[model samples]
Every structure is written in structure tokens, then in C-alpha cells.
Target: METRSLGEHERSTSQSPRVIALANRAGAPAGHVVLSAERISKSFAGVRALQSVDFDLRHGEVHALMGENGAGKSTLMKILAGVHASYEGTIEVDGTQAAFTGVRDAEEAGVAIIHQELNLVPELSVADNIFLGREPLIAGVLLDRRRMVRAAERLLERLGVAIDPESRVAGLRVGEQQLVEIAKALSLRARILIMDEPTSALSASECETLFKIVRQLAIDGVAIIYTSHRIEEVLDLADRVTVLRDGKRVVTAPIGELSHGAIISAMVGRELAASDRGAAVQDGAVVLSVRNLTLDTLGPHGWRRTLHGVSLELKRGEILGIGGLLGSGRTEILESIFGVQRGWRGGSIVVNGETADIRSPVDAYRLGLALVSEDRKERGLHLYESIGDNIALPSIGALSQFGLRAFARERALARGMVRQLAVRCTGIGQQAASLSGGNQQKVVIGKWLATEPRILLLDEPTRGIDVGAKQEIYKLIFDLAAQGLGIIVVTSEMPELLLLSDRILVMCEGRQTGLLRRENATEETVMRFAAPGMAAWPHGTAS
Candidate 1:
């Protein structure tokens, strides 16, 4: 690894200045003002979720909202969407005071929100979903399916999305499904659109399409509220940016006025530590192996293969990195290994030189396996339960013997793991839902640690956590790897993959496209393998 001098760091710091300016006026006093939120504050069960945040939206502008998880971005957006009716604030829409009592009310007021986790019924067809609650009816009672299909087709055509309007949504890929969600919102005749991490599940090309749609919406005078953790996307797409930190509005400015470094510094209140791009392990024993793994795609026996004879080896004391654009089946690999996908066929899993039959989570758990799933809230924790219960849930069987619950044993185990994992909580009995985003993640890690898994599957483990918490998790991962535990990490962050992996595997369109040893791996090589258009892995140094 190369090192830079303090002089260079100082010089880089002083290369930019702070300023902000609005742009591309559409209407309204030459300012394009559409909506303004003044002194908005909200609390949940006595906990302040947002505190006196002032925000603005303009016609024909894509305004980006940014903050770490639990930093008030979602709370503010929810208020705008009328999910929280009791928030204290004054919202003026086109210089008229407005208030909403429900999501329906917000939609009636020309507001629409597309959440990170899509709200769609897979059993329904794309056309039905687009016209979902407010379907165009022939009469007051009878439905109009043909008109709905035609409308859906037109919507997709406008966005340049190629997909059957009558196709079952369940069979679509994540990216295509996201487009359908947008179409549903557009059907609402929205003047103000709130998009939360819209491109998170999109491939590079899919992202480009979404960007074009956003641009088109802006050109049509739509006021857009865009939020994402991907900084590069904000730089490319946003007209103006508003940042929130610790439930307070830190700054609101035009995109061109803020450099990438300045945005990072403002969001984090400090510079990002220069990421170390190197291996976190040495060559070690091969602990996990797969041969000819395949999964039939989802549908009524849809035979579109999501995984195709994929094979890989993960060594003990190594962080095996899985790299791919979203929807490329990188997540499926982990799910298959953890027994989440039972439709997998023609695969042999060898762990520590022994053939493993992992048909269910029980089978995987008994073999000392742990999985931190991609959607942490959906797959990792029981939100209504206490932190103690969640951390010891996997090992609860041990706490109950002969049909008797061992309360003392459970408490003792939870306490031990909490200390070991450095989990922050008001108390062991505190609700898991009460903890902050970073602490909730720690509890998830603690749950797996209690089982003492020999193999660990981590999917976007550090996403949305604060910088301090991320550093702690990295240290914990390093400690576990040092103890010879086999760790497989699936991450979207290219820098994270470069820094943590001993060996990297790049997947594209359900295929293991290429492999790189520690000495051979670089950002360029991994990206080339992961990108769909690259014919072969290119040899080069990292940028």
C-alpha cells in the first residue's frame, strides 16, 4: 500500500470552497418555488424523529435529500407523504397552506412516494398494479381491464421501458419491478414525487433509464424529492441538495456548488478516512465449496435460470467478496448457501471436506452457519421483540429444555453476547425496535455470534450504518476472520470489496464471470468482470 504525505492531504482539502446556487428556473418569481416546509418537527413515542427541519422544493427541479439512517430523511419524507399526520410544521404548496391526514389525502394533493421496499402485489399483473386503487372504471361498479392495460403500456413506453404490461409482476426482475412502481405513482398524476433509493436494485443500464425518466419529469415541471446513499448518483442527477444530520437540516444547496468531498464532510462532519484497498487475509484452508449450483427463476414453474452452474471456494480466515450489479444473482448465491432458496438443483456443497445437505435453515444452522440477510429488517430481526430476545433467538432452543423455558439462561446468554458484540441498548430487555440503526445492526451481528457459526454470510452488512459503527463492524469481522472463520461478503460498494476481500468473485447475469486473487484484484478488474458488456477481465492497477 502506498502512503501520501500530510502536505498532499492539506493541499487537497484547500482545493475547494463552499457555495450554493439554484438553477434552471421554470416559473414563480424567477425562482421556480413549488413547496416550502417550515420548522417541521416530529416525534414518535416521546423520541424526536425530526427536529425543526426547513426544506424547499421547486418546480422542474430534482432535489436530493441525504443523511445517514435514522438521521431524519425518512421521517421528513413520511411527513410529506402524509404517513405522519401529527407532525408539527407549516407546509405551503404554491403559496397556499396545506395539511394532509393520510396517504390518500397526499395523493389527492398531487403527492406520490416510491418507497425503497416496493409496495406491489406480485400476484397482480403490471397493468392492474399501475391502476391499482384508482382503476379507471367503465361504470361506478364495473372494472375496465382493457383501458388499464392500454394506459400501462403508454406509461412504460413514455419511460422507454420494454416489458409486457399484462405480465405478472412476480416474474419480473427487481429493476423492472421498480419501473412498474414508478408507473403506478405516475398514474396518480403526481406533481410532487418522492423517490427513496430508487436505483438501489437497478443495474447500470436500468439506472440510466431511471435517470432519463427523472430528467423528463423535471422537464415537465414535476417537483421531485430524491434520496440515496450513492453519492455519485446525487452528483449526476440532483439540481439542488438538502442534507440532514441528527434530525436537523444541516445545509441546502445547489449540486454544482458542493464537491464530493464537501458533501461527505457535511454529512459525516469530517472527512472520510482514505479507504485501504488491500486484502484482509492470507491464503488459508478451503472451508466452503460449491459445484454446479443452479436455481430456477420465480414464476409458475418459470425455467429462466437465475444461477447457472456457479462454482466457488471460500477459504478459512478469508473474506471472500462477491461483486455484481444488482439483479445479477450475487444475492442468490448467499441465499442458496444459507438454504433460503429450496428450488436450487444440481449443486453440491462441501464444507471442511464434508458434503453438506442444507435444505433448510435448520440444516444450515446445525452445521454452524450464519446469514446476515440483505434486507436486515425483513430477514434479520423480530422488530417487535426486545433486543435480548432478538440476539438470543437463534439459540433459544438451548434455553428451553424438556418443554420448560429457562429465563435465567436466556438473560445470561444475551448479556454475554451483548458485551462481546459491544451492542448499545438502554437495557438487555429494551425493544430492538427502540435502538438506532447502527445498534440494531450490532444486535443482528450478536445474534449470529451467539451461535458460534463456522461460516458467515454477510449481505451489505455495513450499509446505512454510521461511520463509527461501520469501523466497529469491520474490526469485529477482522477478529472473526483471524479466528479462522470463513466469511463471505456480498457488497455493492466497490471500495469495500477492494479493501476487505482476500479473493474476489465477480458475477454477471447469474454466472461467475471471473475470479481475482488478492495480488491480482483491483477496482478496474472487479468492475470489468461485473459489468455486462466486458468480454474479458482486463489487467490493470486501481484508480
Candidate 2:
């Protein structure tokens, strides 16, 4: 939280003369310009991904590039990282015009980028992956394994990361993998580091550690280009901010000049309406019920219980929330109800007052149940397929005739779902990978809607999306609940849980610790229940 002035690192002897010259142009005694791009424009098959966008980075400063999904932030970063060589732009490094033809070219020019989707080989050792292509060699042929491991150890130590260099990447956790990625970037001696959504999948504790490393890098005269959808992180870490919208630069200013609302307005091009969850829906009949669900799993410590006699109920047209810390079995409850938990036992599920037999996801879907898992990329949509194909995948039989898929009817259904969900895409034929994060999530939801589900199980539905897209999703959820759909949402964000749920179920160590109505839920109350081994509340406190 300490504030360091840009001038604090100006006296470093490592700065190049060109950087000093660029610093003089700023008309202030601060860090010099390390990299700049002017009039960056790119097009893909007649679609303009970026147009006349301008950006610059200064030595020892953390500059944030932010925008809604499909707003050209990634496109611009790709150009800077040399991933797209056909872009129309002029890049200047150290006050000299530079043209990078490939990723290697950018790295050689002292610029490196860590993509949002990590690019590490899971089967390779940490040291081998870090120095894969540029590995040290003896006699111009033999691999220098010792040298590579030693170098990797030094880099990891510099970043305050503790990981065995000989360990395979497949066994590491997400946060450790991220740190390895950073260590790899630093091995290139990069003067400008571009990190895209670095903390998207990281836990709260890991984020703090990463923040410390980022700040330290800046103090060491590294120019950092940071991009994230989390606005609070931008406010906390960025020295300056550049916002892009619709493939054009909207504004560039000091972080002190922007407020939370201003940044949201600029990214979305309008004010986002606050969610109104107070207009309570009159509770209808019990739509789904679960009794005494339990699960056993083998972990590092040995056999352990994941879920301990968990029970919950959902009413028609109601949004029920599940809240808990990570590993508190919030996701397990949904997986148990959806029949995806293979080890679940001693549970009875009743749908509309009849004993239901849901042994698999297909059975759950046939019972008018749908689950939108948290990891969309891995579990939800097929990225390689078209939007229409993904949407029609769940209900192919319904759209088929004589065992042949009805193409015309399938396209019509996909189009209808896209329209209903307000999905932004060029057409139904576009691949799911081409769409942004928000649209990808929408497609996942649309695929389930094709099955005509009555009860929706959404887990972290808004996890890596922008504020504007989150607002749209909230509206969509409310609309669905109004149409008599029972919604069960499991979220880690406290505000989202409070804003969306009429009643919340708090879990602690896989047990139903507390249930609070909307009128009584607060951050403190929810945390108290979510804490492990908390004392029992008074009888009748839970609604």
C-alpha cells in the first residue's frame, strides 16, 4: 500500500539514454518512457479489432489497460507482444522505431508478455519449460541441465516463489504455475512486462503475493503493463490507466483522476444500472429438495469427508445462494445435486415431490435440471465448434428428424437463444473461441437453455467478465427467476451473493452451518457462519 514516486528510480544507472530523452518529453522529473505504440490498427476478415489506438509505458510504472470484452484490449496487447505481425502500427522502444516480426523479436527487444491463457507444457519440468527454446548448451549440442536448474532457481528466488525446478508443471497448482510463468518472463531480462489477467484464477492470498512481486519489479525499474477485469486491483496497483472501447482509445490519465464509476462508464460507454434484488418473488411450491448428502474423497492427508450431511431446498421462482470459502464444499453441493459427484451417498433428491434418480448429468438434464460449471473453458462449451453447434449440442435429438440433424431448425434455435441472451457476435457461424469471455459464458447458458431446463445451477457465473457484462448477466438471471425457474448460485464474491439471493445457505467444512434470509444477511454474519468450527447459533435463527 506504500506509494512510490516515479522519480524514486530515475537515478538508476541501468536506464538507457533514449529512455531519459523520452522522460524529458513528459515535462516532469519522473521515469522515462520505455515503450510506446502509435496509431495501432488491426483487422480480421473485414472486422476492425483495433483502430487508431495509442498507448505508452514508462519506466518503473504500472500502467493498466482496461476495457470490456471485445473492446480491443487483447488485440492491442497482441500487437505489442508481437503475436500479430500484420498490425498497422508504429512501435517505439527506447525512442527508436522497432518492428517485431515474432515473439522472439519482441523478447529480444526487451519486451515480454504473459498471456491470460498460460502457455506452459504440462509434461515438462519447471526448469525445462522455463528455458525450453533457449536452453543452455555445451559444445553447441549437449543440454546443460545443471546450468538450467541453477538459473531457474535464481529466478524463482528473485520472485519469492518456492517450487522445485525439477518438478513437472502438471503437478503444480494454478498460483504456482502463474509464478513460474512470471519467473520465465523475468529470465528474458525483460524491461517491459505485459501481464494479462494474471490474477484471474488466483486465490486472495496468492493475489497478495503476486502484487508484492509486481510492486518490487517496478521498484527495480521494470515497466509493467497490467490488465485485469477487476477494477479494484487497477485502483490499487496501477500508476496510470489507459482505457479502450470499441477498438479505440477512450482516455489515458493518472489513476488519481479516475473513480470507480468513471472507469465503468468509460469501459461500457454508459452508466450500468445497479441490481435490484429487493423486489422479492412470491415463493411457489418446492421445486427441488435434497436431504443428507455426503461425499468421501482421498486427499493428500488420507480418506476424508467432503460433504457432511448437507441439505437444502429450492422454491420455484427463487434465487437461492450458496456461500463458503474455497474448499468449503460449496461446489460439491451443486455437483452432488446434479449427479456429477461419483462418490456421493446417503442423499435423497426430490423433484416436484417425487423421488428423483439422478445418477449422471444426462439424468439430471432429463429431469429439467441444468448446471453451468465454474470452469467454462474446460467443462462448458466446445471452443473449436461454432456457436450454433455448441448451442444445439445439448438438445440434438429435439432438433433432429429421422436420426438426422435438422440444420435449418438447429440454426433457428441457436439464433433465437443468442437473441434471447443478448449475445454479441458476428453470426451463428462464428466459432466459440472467437467470442469474448462474456459471450462465451452466454453461449454456455444458451446451450443449457436449449434443453428447456426448469432448475438452473450456476457456479461463479460472472467470474472473469467485465462490469458491463456482469450487469447483463444479473438481469438475465432475474428474468429467468421471474419466469418460474429455480436458481441455485454458488459464488465467492460477497456482494454478488447478497445482491442475487433471496436466501443464502452458508457452508463450513461441508456442513450447513447457517441459513439467512435476505433481511438478515450481512458480510460479518456470512463470514461468521462460513468460518470453521464456529459456535452454533440460537435455535430458530435460520429461516
Candidate 3:
């Protein structure tokens, strides 16, 4: 698969002349080497992060760097971008030896990196953040706010995104914040670009826009180092891929030379079996039902209705998937049902056939409902806190005896959850930040599971985790469903939703457009109803 098969995007833009130009740096031919790292070895507190890793990028190439979490992918990328200055290695830029002392040095050398974790200041406007330290000056004195905002708008337009330049980043959603981050990177106009899991927070529609941008950049001869867990997209976009496993480069070849199995095998050092979607369990009684779920928010333009009479049902032991592009009210539906979404205008929630007036998370929790938020670092976990402390947060009251805390009970419960989830850690006392992406996600899920909820709501259940951990979590969901826990999963990945869902509920603009049986759920069918104006799904049903 290649960008040609991604379909033609009509967007076309001319770069700003006043903004930093992104010409062919080093005056090299299209296929000439632009950047290289030889025998790069790094360590952290005595642990070897990378073992003599070697990688190279060309003038007009989309090189994909791949590996599981903590497999030395980030370490090598950080070394290249000058984030890790203490690494032992030789870096060459444009056939000349170069040592970057810091990120500014790398940027000055025509290199810019977009980290997987967002690095924007929430207090600043989108335009301010885009040109943070390099804000243009009027006559080299006054801040050129007009030029900065215009340039930012052009960058957003080039990416086909509709974010306002004046809007503060704090008010934006995770996906929107990610778009801002990309815009910030593009504003640099660097010849060498590195993107780490750029699409982890983007929606299907936004991803299309980004793919178009990437394709255009490649045609313009900008070298890009793209990293992603979504192998399918990599197969479509990258010209070559370099697989790193446990800190060493296993293979570097043209994308066409390797199959999906080959990539997975190289990453984990084993052939992984495809996930089997076993037969759906026998029907269980309805556990949750929502009717006329309406929500409104006080935006700049007064009150805007985000949810429009969305309705759904979850039965015991069944996994119901909510599928949609970003801002389609997928997360809002979950939050509203969990009594977290703001300004609930009208809605009726029925749990176990009883009408419930749930207004807060505590009320929902009391009724045996738990929500695992999409962002683990910010909302789900205390990164600096110990694993045992995090898992025992919600259940502290229940684990206590009178006014005194039951330390032994907390440790016992944490140990049980850790063993059940297979979280690899030194001990329960280890800080959550010390764990890998997969282990951190497990802790988030485990903490919510400790609440012992009958209904579970998971948003982006496997976002930013590796393939191995994804498989384990998939199996765990099935196992939990089999034990009669009703689950609702909100995911942007089509294949994941299809695999884990017993029935798929498609949403568009906050409206429930289609309800598909597991057998009827395909990528094409789901998109038919999920995308607005894909011709109305006449046969679509809510029942």
C-alpha cells in the first residue's frame, strides 16, 4: 500500500514566504542521505537503553521507526533530536559530523520532532504556542501578533484542520490538542521531521488530513521519520521501515519487502497469533439503558448542543462498541451515562430496569458503573504515586476500618489486581511513571476494576500501547465479558472495534445513525453510517 492508494485529497497550499522556508537542505539529490546515526549506544542509570543502534534517512523518504514500548525506539529518536545529550554515538547531518547540544541546536540544524506526549502550554493561544520562542517582531521590536496568527491559520489550513488561531489550547479536546501540536511542528519548516505516534490522538477524518500533508511533504523532498503503532497506516505511507527490538535494529528494509507477520515477529521476537473472536455468549438481561440523552455546553457562541437524543443499551456479558470519528459525541455519550458530562439537558438513565437520577461520578459509582478515561497520565493515574497508592485511590474508603486505614487490605488488593493484570513492575511500591505504556494502562483499568462495577465504560481502551499488550487487553475484555460484566468500548480504530464488539453502535454528529450486529460490522459498513453525508444509511436501525 502507498499514498497513491490513500485517495487524492483536493487540498493545495502555498508556503508563506516570510515564514521559515523548507527548501532542499544541504542541496542534495532526492535519494541522497540527509541524516545518519552510527553505533548509537545510550543508557539510563546503568540500564542500557540502546545497544549500538544504526539508522539513516534520505532526502525524500518517509522512514518508519518501529518497536514495542521501551524497545529503544524513543531512546534512539530522542538521541537524534538532541533530547538525550549524554548518549555515546556519532551523528551526521548532510554527510558532515554534527553534535547537537540541545533541542535548539537540532532545530538550527534543520531537525524538528513531534513527541508522542503533547508538549504545548495550555495557557497560550494556538498561534502563540505555534511560534512560542520564535515569535515574529514588528521592525524587530514589537510582537507581530497579526503575522503570527495569519501564519498559524495558513498552517492549519494546509493540514485541512479548522482550529481557530485565537482559541486557548486548554479548552481543546485531546484530539484537537494533537492537531495543534502538528501545526506547531509544521510551523518550524524543518527539512528533517520526526513524528512519534502522531495519530494516536487523532480521529479517522483528521488522520486522512494528516496523511495528505505527509504525502505532500514527501513529494516536496522533506525527510520524515514517522513512528506509529498502527502498522496498517505505516504500510500505506512509509517508504522504508526500521524495526528495533530490545535496543538493537533487527531489520531495515523497503516497506514492500516485509509482511505484517514479519514486522510483529521482529518487534516481539515471536510470531503472535491473530486474536480469535470466539462465539458470542448467550443473551443476558439488560444491565443499562439510556433514552433521549441530550447534553449542551456553554461555548463562545452561547449554549451549543453536543448530544442530540442519543440512546443505547448494554446487556450483561456483552460488549457494545460506540464507533465514530473524533468530536462525534462518542466520549460525551459515555460521560453523560456515567454522570460526568456537563449540562445534561434531558435524559433518562435506567439501570437494571430502575429509573436513576445520576448526577455525579459518585452517584454512578454507587450504582456499580466505572469509567476508565482515555488519558491515563492526566486523569487516570498519579504518575509520581506508587502503584499500590493509585490502585487503592477509589477503594480507599471501602478498604479502611472505621477512621483508620487498613494497610494490609490495600496491599492484598493491589497484589491481586497486579497478578490478575500481569503488570510487570519491581513491586506495588514502584512509581507509576516507572512502568511502560502497557503496564500504565493496566494500572488504570485495574484501579477502575477494583470498584467492582457491573457496567464498565472504556474510552480508547488501548490507545498508545504496543501490539502485545493490545492482545492481552483484548483477551481480558473477553474474559471479563464472559463473567457477566457489561462493557461499552469507545475506540477510533475500526479493526479493534470490530473485534471486541458484540454489536456496533455508529454515531455521527452525536446522533445514533446505525446499530450493526457483530457479523454485519465491517469497515466499509461502519464508515457508511459513521461519516456524515456518506449517503444516508436507509437500512440502519437503532434496535
Candidate 4:
């Protein structure tokens, strides 16, 4: 692998505007345009999501759509994927103007889209998910199970993915589920493929595999629209880059003419400050401690231990990071600490030197502990409920009077939280489902802040949001730590773990493999402990 300083690249690219323009012109050569969108405009509820955005995809090229949250990247992709039929645009495929009525129409026109969220029924078999609507029939009336499995096998083999066709989708890992989504797209014989943040949940190794598959697909003459927040991945994978800001096209250039800083600047319309991962910080006394934590998960193969005597210490005014691959007990630790794990046992939890009895989330909260779960939609917020209601749910008792609900007090508390968190919304009455990803995350954090907890357990705090939102969340974490709150953050992004963590505890296969201070932590050093079967670090005295 080549080693190039992103800072140096940004400095050099900042001085070369003409190079960018030349690369943009050189992107699509003659007779190579496979798909083009002209003057695309879209609006929803009187708000413009996109305005006269023009984009083009060439044959055998990876065109990346870059932007911050609510910057119309997904809206524009939805237009191409036929998810939104009411948009002003001229779309041409194969040099002929075309209009799609729905997603089925787009698929029929040789277009397929893999959404950021995996859309599959977990109870269904892999084969059934791949050939869901258009299954092969034995005699036009009966379902051809054998032929469907066989066809699914062929698709998986083509992508170099190894998974059982007859296995339930629920049993597969997230990376495997992503491969299934890709296989489903390829089974449509798609000529144009749209991938939206395809690697948000994938591990480092799985990401490399997905990148290889993407390159091979491009080699096979498929035009791909790749969207991601990881700038390094974009730099490595994309052939051409198009940036959007405030719902308008900013620039389109080849990857060679762009740098990490240049692309970020284009996306946010400003030069972003470089992140300092090793900032100096003072560590206070241990505020939270766990000893001999273990959890058992019931599976088809019977009960199995997921956590094996995991232990860690979190200090007041300190950001503790838990780094590990998927299913490595990082999340389970949080769940166990929050008292939400069903079969967790043999754990002794101490809060501020007091042995705490946390039999449920209610008990955990009563003991000054709050957990911001990874699945915000399912666990953190009520999607259909009003924003004010979601914010006030956890603190209803305090806002109530004489065992009756105090509507006025509830509204006041909700308004204060919304303002404090800078949660962008029409009003407190706006449903949580209507807000953008970043604002929704803020609301989740605000809900926990309402509890006045001394310890915060955050699992993937900035999972699916864009770069701008991520920066805001990082600042929020720092602010919370400055306020003397003990924070434990579990994140898949290595840069995030290093940037926000005062000290990182690396886990592998349900064990603490290594612990390193912020100054000593690096991607390679962390991964050495995060990988399975790695040697464990020597125990250090609790600070």
C-alpha cells in the first residue's frame, strides 16, 4: 500500500484549481456516457432538497456522490433509483430520455440500488431474499425452491461471497447481509448500480473485500454510483468525484485531482480544521468500574457465552473508547452495563466507589447511568411520536405534578432540550421520524441528558450521519467530558475512536486484548488487539 500524507496532498491540491477543472473535463470521454441527469430539481414540503443538480456516470467508472447530511445526495440518488417519481429532471440512459414510475421500473430498466440500511426479512432464507418478487417458477404456478437456491448460489459465487443459500438471513453477520444485498442487485442484471454508504457497518477486512468486488464490477462494464462519508475510501475507490452542498452541485472532478481536505472543503463549503487525536487531558478518579462481566446468548445451537469476564474502568472527565470488530462484545458490554442484556450474569458494577444493583435499565438510570444504544430508531426514540414527547419520555416523573401529567412543564423541558442540543426541527410537535439523521441523534443524546446521569454509555454515537454532523457530535462528546461526565464510546470508525478517546480499550473475541493511552494508540496497534486470537496486554493499575 502506498503511504501518502493527506495533509500534504491537501496543501498541494489547494494550489491547483486548474488541475481540478481539467480533470472534470477529462472524466467522461466521447461515447462513454452511460447515465446522465440534467437540471435535476426536487422539493418536499415546500423545502428544496435538490436544485438543478447535474450528474453523469460513465461506463466502467465509480462516480462518488459526496455531501453532508440533508445535502440532497440521497434525494438525488433516490431520483435515479426511482424512489421519487415527482422530480424535475431529464434522465437519459443509453442516450435516450427515460422516466421511471417506481423502483420496479428502474430495475426493469437495468438499474439497481443498495440502500444504506439493509432491506431484507431476517426470517427468510438468503435465496428467498435475493429472488423475492421475481422468483423462478416450476410451472408458472409453484415456487421453484431448488432453482432459486441454485441461482442464488451462482450470484454469491460471482461476487466471491461464501454463505449458505438455505440459511436464514438473520443468522448471517452484517457484512454477509451486505453481500446478499449486492448479490440481489447483481441478480437483476443491473447495468447501473447505486451504493449508498455500503461500508458503514462493515469491518476493515470486509470493507476490503467489498472494494475488490466493486472494482471487479466496474471491470465488467457496470457504471456505479458510490456514496460514502469515509474520505480515504473515496480517495482509494472512486474514479470521479462529485460534491454537493446546500442542495446544489459544487464541483465534479476525477479522484486524482482531489485531496482529502479538498473534498471535505467542497462538501462543507469551508476549510475544516484538522482533527487532533492526541490532545492533552486530565483524568479524574474512576467513576465507573465493571468486574467479571459475562453474557449468554440463546441461539439455534443453544446458549453460548458472548462476553467472557470483560472488565474496564472509566474515569470522570475522561472519554473511554472501546474498539473491536463486530460481535466482539463491545456492544454487549454496554448492554450489560445498562442492565438490558437478558442473560448477563457474574458482573460487579461500581458507580463512584459504590456497589450498584442494576437489575434493569430503570435501575441503571436510577443509579446515574444512561445508555445511548446503537439502534436509535428501535431503542432510543419513538419514531411516530412528537419530538417533544420523545424528549420528555424519560423524565416524565420530574415534569409531572401530583401523579398527573403536567403538559406545560413537559413542553417547557422539551423546548429547553431542543434548544440546548441545537436540534433542527420545524417545532417540538414535529415527529421524530421527520427529522434528519443528525438531528435525530441529537434528540437521542438529549433524552439521556435529561436523566442527569454521571456515566454515559454511547454505542456508535455517529454511525450513519455525514461529516459535518460527526464533527458536531465529537464536540458534544468533548463538552460532556469537560463537564465531568464519564463517557464510554464504542465505535467502528478507527479515526473516531482515536480522536475522542482519552484512552482506548481494545477487545477481541469477548476479551480485553489491549489497552492503550491516546498518545500511544494507532490504527495498526489497535487492530492488532482487535483482531481475533491476538495476545492480551498486561494489566495496568487503574488510574
Best by lDDT: 2
Q: How do all the candidates rank in terms of TM-score, highest first?
A: 2, 4, 3, 1
Estimate the lDDT of model 3: 0.85
Every model: Cα RMSD to truth: 8.6, 4.4, 5.7, 6.5
Per-residue lDDT over 1-543 for candidate 4, one digit per residue giving the tens place of the 0 to 100 score: 111233443475564423433343355341288899999999989999999999999876789999998899999999999999999979998888889999998898888999988999999999999999999997799998989999999989978888999999999988899999999998998889999999988888899999988876765667899999899998888888999998999999888788888998998888877555345354658999999888888877988888888888888888989998987889989988988956747779999999988889999989899999998888889999999999999999887899999999889988998998888888899999988788999999998898889999999999888888888888888888888899999999888998988889888888888888887889998888887778754542122
Over 1-543, each residue of candidate 2 has an lDDT whose tens digit, in order, gives 122334554554467534543343343333778899999999999999899998999887889999999999988888898899898879999999989999999999889999988999999999988998999999989999999999999989888888999999999988899999998998888888999999988877789999988877877778889999999988888888899999999999887778999999999999988898566675669999998888887777887889888878899999999998888899988988888954736679999899999889988998999999999999998999999999999999887999998999999999999999989999999999999999999999999988989999999999889888999999999999998999999998888999999999998887878898988999998998988787533321467
Q: How much is 255 displaced in model 4, in angstroms?
A: 0.7
Give the TM-score (vs. native) of candidate 4.
0.91
TM-score comparison, 3 vs 4, better candidate: 4
Residue pairs that clash (backbone atoms under 3 angstroms), model 2: none
TM, every model: 0.84, 0.93, 0.87, 0.91
Give Cα-based local distance difference scores for all models.
Answer: 0.81, 0.88, 0.85, 0.86
The list of candidate 2 runs beyond 4 A from truth reads 1-30, 342-344, 536-541
| Candidate 3 least-lDDT 10 residues | 17-26
Prediction-by-prediction clash tally: 0, 0, 0, 0
Q: Please report, as a residue range, the 10-residue window in candidate 1 with the lowest summed lDDT.
A: 17-26
Superior by TM-score: candidate 2 or candidate 4: 2
After superposing candidate 3 on the true structure, give the runs of residues whose Cα lies further than 4 Å from its correct spot: 1-30, 125-127, 136-189, 533-539
* Superposed model 4: Cα runs more than 4 Å off: 1-31, 275-283, 537-543
Tens digit per residue, CA lDDT, model 3, 341-368: 5774588999989998888999999999
